[model samples]
Target chain A: MPEAEAGTLVLDCDELEELAGALALGAALPQEVAAAQAHLDGCPRSHTDVYELATVARLLAEAPEPVEPPARLRARILATAREDTAPQDAPSGIRYPVSGGGGPVPGTARAPAPARSSLPRRPVFFLLAAAAALAALALGLWNLQLRGELDQRQERLAAQQRFIDAFAGGGRSVAFAPAPGQEALHGAVVRRAQGPALAVFTALPRPAGSDVYQLWAIRGSTPQDLGVFVPDARGHHIATLPDLTGVDAVAVTLERERVPAPTTAPILTAPL
Target chain B: MATGDGPAVSDPDAALLARLVTRDEAALAELYDRHGRAAHALALRVTGNAETAQDVVQEAFLALWRRGHTYQPERGAVRGWLLTVVRNRAIDALRGSGGQVARVLPVDTLVLAATDNPEAEAMQAVDGRRVRAALAALPPEQRDVVELAYFGGLAYPEVAERMGIPLGTVKSRMRLALERLRGSLRAWERDA
Candidate 1:
């Protein structure tokens, strides 16, 4: 990282343009490299200037006079490239089948041309069709990746909205204390002074097969069974609990299914 | 398919690049016949050793053969792309071998298709005589710094260190010399 202009932290347009000249050959002392890129990203004119200058710099790559290369060098390079056309067959995903540069190893043949034509019928047409299909496949995969990203963003947005709604209700939050040896679990019970309550958990251990975390409302000595809920892949669950009328506490236990009564000890407890 | 070291009139190089993607060895040979001398010259200039230059050129051609599918026509001409690869590989070899490059004026040419004059060739070769003449036209100091940075593959500061000049001087001289070269190439195309 070459130092930018001395005593200056931010570069102006003029300074960036001055740097663009050197950027042609990647000779710019861009300790301010990030700033230069940011400038190029925003300024179309300077971006084009840098590109054109780079093309000019590239021209310097040609020899003024010229010298012929060794004839044997040409033969060696072409032969090696032809051999490299074979697909490297690595049976184990963890390790390459072969290492180092040379001709194709045994058992590997140059990947047979596109699979569209076994019989040589209209070879050109089949080749074109295969190429078109490959291009379409690439485009489809790119679209699928974008859709996945969009879905994740929407999910995050919905989660944030839920958090905001809970906070805006001005409810008192009761922390759900985890049982000993299960400190990774955390939850909270949000209740308005006189309305419905909500239960949210994070890092909730996913129960074993055919099991769920059952919720119970404890009033005095009696425990009224609420319902069962499962956590998402990230070990998070949020659900609105039933009316909290006269309910002094809440408890959760891992159970095989919704039971009429408590089957085991509470894994989490929260006081109203 | 046209293999000759003459002026480029049509888009023949594009066909050669397409052939390269298909693993056609004859196309590779034809391309080598056309540009191998120039590639070798550039490599030798940078690495300062004929043997090292040969290796660099060979590696560059092999890389072109392997990575041809990744080329985007929108970027620029095939000849430009080929020479850039050769220059980069030579620089890499020079760095690895710790070799030194002697300073001289560096020349460059890119013939944009003559939009205004259809009679003009798509790419006019600026022969060695004209290239050396353009190099001679530059101020000695400006030309020297341009050669050191462009051919030596050194950063501006390194050019400064080698020439015993301030870093700013090296930067400005390089800029001027290259800008002038761009102008000269365009002017020569018009003259041709």
Candidate 2:
């Protein structure tokens, strides 16, 4: 047990219970948060308990495979980021409304600032200054655009890292063998947590036309498409199954573009 | 999966934050791309409105931009920190007005996906399906209290009020639920 400081109150067991619940959910009132922090400053045991509880809360937050955000939200966030990076004096004259309407932001449509009268008043000097200003603006905008793309790539990699992390531990793997004349083909499906399934294949044949290998999760008589993929030169293919819960079997088939449903029999499968 | 035993010297988040302190927008956007979905989902679940959830997510990221200095990685994973901010903001929105705002659920990525922890790796790898199943296994009474307090973001007294139960009962239910959850996840660890 930790002692309370002057003008501070230590949480008892019941209060600690409430603090844990609030901390896990991020719903603690400001005063409650302050109080909890105060107590934690003096208590090591309580801190560990709170940390573990928060981990459980995080697990709940991530139980679902994923839901894609509206396309415009990404644009809106990037637009705001650009505005924030705009030169302090000029305040990049752009804005994207947070309402997500994809409408132009208000108070952003404005004419360029007038030149300060302190500069040389000659026409040639004025033109030169304007050119210099334009060049600087172009450079800044170009940098912003480049940074945006790099940021987008970094995010995609981070997402992939998470996808890999999802099965980095505690997933079960099942092997798939080739059928009949397809003795060269070998595959495996790693079932992760609840629904994400990672499938890997080797020695797959390249399909002609727009045909590609599509993965499926078979439960009872019905089957669902996990995703589609193409094998590499060594004939290796790996695909992620977003939602594979209730899957009694896993299979892969070759299908042409625009085909929503399975078009051919599975060349490989791992029955759960 | 990366283990907590190793030094976090090469932690990507620490590197990202270092860049962010230099006012790098790319680092911020990359951070958002990594954790935005989970943060958005938590806000949506709590605030019960897509718009409010979006606002909460944006606010959380901006706060990170402004307060990156406050973060201490040794305390916990960055995803947990972002989700906590979102949840707190959602609660503020809800409590400030007696209005319902958004309703949505889980999304494409786990926030703590790249952290070095077997539990996190296993949870994400397994999606803590067992933990969810264990939660589902609890008696509905116990489950209700846990959900109301955790997901619902209601204080214990509010949880009791919402369920028409005694405050003491709510406390006991929460205690029991947490003990059961710890036992269940620990059991899963051993089985793994």
Candidate 3:
């Protein structure tokens, strides 16, 4: 976004510095990332310096203590792993009850021939087999949940991409940044005469309980509430406002649910 | 190539990977049990939500399962590799299709350092706490720059504007802070 030339495949010292900065920021566009990779691949000196910076950046990314995934997630991961890796013909690898006739159970492979005749059949085998089946079902459900989430993210990205592209062709774009010492909220707004004005924000801090961050289009003393939005990971929030004609300013406020007007102060405001 | 403290009877990450390559589900489970929490935490921090974090973890581990053969022991520990992949996926999700560049990732800098012993050592030697302590020790202004750039995921100019500082100041602070962190981490590596 700062007008760094991304077409250069071979980077000079200045380019290398720029690349390092981009990498640290995780703001490298696809081409920039490739160019940085090419430069690092070709130039060996001080490459480690760049690598060290990346390592440090990565460490900072994981600075927060790890949180345990839900129990169902673990089960789903394991079940999917087994279901994927296990061959259809092969036994589920989970030992099951050998019937009195010494044949394969309904869903599982049979025990070894020699053991089948000699080993005593127990009721617990059925229970274990049933439990294993249920676990597999749970894992399938969990996998579905994961897929649904992936689809949602994809849909959001597609919608944002469309919104951005349409505005990029002909529109006025305003970039927003946090006020001094404030890092929780930053974003941009794009307005096009032919379409609705779109605001795409990132890292918007969550309001305390039941409260939401509402977007307002300000004209004079009166502020129009555009809509309420919550952020996704990376604090991204996007809203398409129906009108933008003669809007003097845009601001975001932390407001209570269903409030008719601005009950409190604005967290972020930018003049149009 | 060393073992992370995990539940596996055979502790080395490489061994687990070998098992994984053979389609051993237990091996995958062992690796997850050992590193899943950290991976999830990193994803949650980057994505800012539990659901997205869950998706990242699911995708990352599945990638490992399907591509475990890609793990080169000489690169680094499996935990480090896994964390890197998880972080990348989360970034991709955050930035959308624009983020998925099929090129060398920032983390690949470490992998490419096999010929450079000192650089490779910086990556292999430092663990989570060492890096955390180094970060915690940075000056507040310096730390803010690093966190906003890396964790907050802003471009350099944006970071400068957000902090209300000059572009030059943001770049200098980042370079200086990184130098200190690299030095501290290298020292910790040597002491260890």
Query: Which runs in model 2 stand beyond 4 Å of their true positions?
Result: A1-51, A85-272, B1-11, B97-131
Model 2: fraction of native contacts: 0.11
Worst 10 residues of 2 chain A by lDDT: A96-105
State the lDDT at A222 in candidate 1. Answer: 43
lDDT of 2 by residue, B5-114 (tens): 11122346666665655567788877767766667766787778888878777777765665565454643555645655665566656655432221211111111222
Tens-digit lDDT string for candidate 3 (A84-123): 5322222232111111010111112211111112333334
Cα lDDT, all candidates: 0.59, 0.54, 0.58
TM-score, predicted candidate 3 vs. hidden true structure: 0.52
- Per-model TM values vs. the true structure: 0.53, 0.47, 0.52
If both were scored by DockQ, which would come out higher, candidate 2 or candidate 3?
A: 3
DockQ value of candidate 2: 0.07
Which portions of model 1 show Cα errors greater than 4 Å? A1-11, A30-34, A44-49, A86-272, B1-9, B97-129
Give the worst 10-residue stretch by lDDT in candidate 3 chain B. B1-10
Q: Is candidate 2 or candidate 3 better by TM-score?
A: 3
Count of residue pairs whose backbone atoms collide, per candidate: 0, 12, 2
Candidate 3 — which residues are off by over 4 angstroms? A1-10, A18-21, A29-31, A44-46, A85-272, B1-11, B96-106, B109-111, B190-192
